[model samples]
Target: MIPDPSAPAPTVRRKPLLAVLLAPLFMALIAVSVINVALTAIGEGLGADSSGLQWVLSGYALAFGVLLVPAGRIGDATGRRRMLIIGIGIFTLGSLLSGLAPNVEVLNISRILQGVGSGLLNPQSVGLIQQHFRGQARARAFAALATTVAVATAVGPVIGGLLIQLLGPELGWRWMFLMNVPIGIAAIIGAFKLIPDDRVRTRTRPDLDPVGAGLLTLAILGIMLPFLERGASVLVWLSLPAGLIVLGLWWAWEQRYKRAGRPPMVDTAIFSQQAFRNGIVIISVYFLGATSIWIIVPLFLQMHLGHTALEASLMGLPSSIAAAFSSQLGGRHVLRLGRKMVIVGFGIAFVGLLCTTILAGFVDAGWVAFWWLAVPLTLMGLSQGLTISPNQTLTLNSVDPRFGGVAGGILQLGQRTGAAVGTAMIPGIIFSLTEGGHSWLEAFTIAMVIIMALTLVAMGVAFADRARETSAPGAL
Candidate 1:
């Protein structure tokens, strides 16, 4: 039910009150990008080696990705608002535990708990937007969501660096986790008071789809472990293929469940839309390249150039500022141009990565020309801000209201899975190049080449397809 482009936008009755519902999602989004800047500090403080450090980073996405679909189903069938509150509670507890963690292993576990909480709260954000808004107003709300996410991604490094500087490396990272406490408390209170109970508005008693949940969890765990767990081992190599097999089984099982008239973890029918499917593909592929910058750029600045966390992060400010501006202003094209904005977004990001590859390949590590980086970083932020929100707008436009939570969960699953894969695989490539006695600059450059290659391939996929324009409504 997408409105005609010429139609006037619908009105949101209580738009100002949305900040409360957006708070937890906003904080969680920031946490995803912020942790990358903390990696060097965390490894040194915990005495973690390369593999251990990778786990410290990827483990959160591991748990977060694995639980998303199940959480979406739970939110859909049960109560989205209640789940959002419970998720805030869980995330707050996880943050406290992470701050207090004495060992890397404990830190990883705490992150998993935080991931679970994040997964639970995330889908509700989408569901609530659908519940309260319609037509053009809904599109604007989604854009606003995108703007918030872009802001998080942009400033994540700065926030992480500031915390690390203020608290000192060994202790600053802990405060990063701890800072979520007060924010989560406020978000919880706001959610309780401001977000209406959409669950009670609907009579559909959504039974928890446990079997589907189990299968999806197992499938994601199998896929992720091989990447997260390093070393050339038989089990590590085998897990990916085995995970693929589990996914095939999961799909088959889901189809059967749908036929049997039971609540399925995913509505298999939703995948039929070319726009939605392609949007997911674009999201995952784009993030694989884009998210890598947050992790690897910081590593390059700190390790290769001998910059402190704060000094290194300052280099990223141009990108963050660009992203914030684009999310609010540049993203307006989605309503007029539809999915074409995504194509333009990809084009800019592709160029940004190309610039990055060339710089990492040719630029001297000790060169004081740090300002050269500002150009590509700004491009990257602009690309992300333009790409993320519009792609989301197109993807959800066609989904049925009843599956909004599930679709939202799948959206996170795609992005996090991309982040987790890129974080795991790309860094491994960089480490391997260094392990072979290559200079740090040479190693990082080689990794950048690979990322650029993949982005090109993703663009080819997008060029062949055009997304349709549509609008979806709320079920509860």
Candidate 2:
């Protein structure tokens, strides 16, 4: 039953609706970071070992990454608000289960369910933004989301530390998950009041490609399983080749399915556009460098520099503040400057990384490290501010708005994949450098080398943005 074309479009008050929609997205970001601080506490409480701890993180990420595309499609077909409410409900329930979990296995299971909730809601936020806003207003909405995510990340450890200190591990860890309860409730209530109910009506049944979903899930698991199990057993090696084969088969199957007039797990056509393709590469590389800092700096400060969690979190303040402000600015300039923002941002970030390497090498005292690290971190934040929001704007703007849900899913998948790889690789780099009785300086140097290499790649892609702009309409 098609809706009447003559019916008037529903009036949606943009600001209030956006605020309501973004609330859940903000809560989701908080959930991710809050757990990072509570990981050790949760592991100890559940009697989990190193592998179990890794599972607690990777399991959620893996589930979240794999399901994002399908969830986005579901929101597009139905109503985004409906999916948001359901997803938030599931997420809140999962958080409760996680807080009450009696064992490592239960906690891990709960984390995966929470990830499912995240996957469902993540794309809906993007879809709703695309549906409701256009041009500058849309850019602002995305910028706000990015800033919220950055701030939440920066505050996570501090909040976790204070909670753990004040309440102790058992109760404190629960608060991390429990914090979502009220936030989620507020989001649900606001969503009902603010979000419009004007969904695209359809009589034809939308075919969900379960086989493709299963294959994609298997492919991601195959790739991620080895990293999660590294240093554990010989089985890790065996999983690698099998995962590669499964992934190859999945890609081929998707192409075949697309030819048969079915919506495959991912839309292959999006990659055909040079701008979209280049945007993905730049995003992956930029995230690789940025995520490495988060993964390595915290561990380095806590283990070698002898700083507490709170202190380390405080040290990250410079970058967080810079990034939040820069993102808004970047959104404003992206339409005018085109891809110049990417080049400028990466250039600044590269210099900051160099300064950071020097500071880490020369500084011995904790206070000295803090002050010196702040300079580079602030640079990084500025660079991030310039790059991320514009990149998102470019990537989304390059695509047809009809495919916004899928595009957002793919973009987010790149981010998670980059983060997982960056997080996994940094520890390996540190471990490898320290093998020959080398000083911490050697490890820091190697990490900086990797970051610089990623920066150069991002710079190269940014330069190529000119060709992409010419080839595509509205690419800037």
Q: Pick the candidate with the highest lDDT.
A: 2
User: Can you tell me which runs of candidate 2 are displaced by over 4 Å?
Assistant: 1-10, 198-200, 230-234, 365-369, 470-474
Provide the lowest-lDDT 10-residue window in model 2.
Answer: 1-10
Measured with C-alpha atoms, the lDDT of residue 296 in candidate 2 is: 76
* Model 1 residue 28 distance off true place after TM-score fit, in angstroms: 1.4
The local distance difference test score of model 2 is 0.78
Residue 258 displacement (Å), model 2: 3.2
Q: How well is each residue in 323-381 modelled by candidate 2, as lDDT tens digits?
A: 89998888777777778877899899999988888788666444464556787878988
lDDT of each: 0.76, 0.78
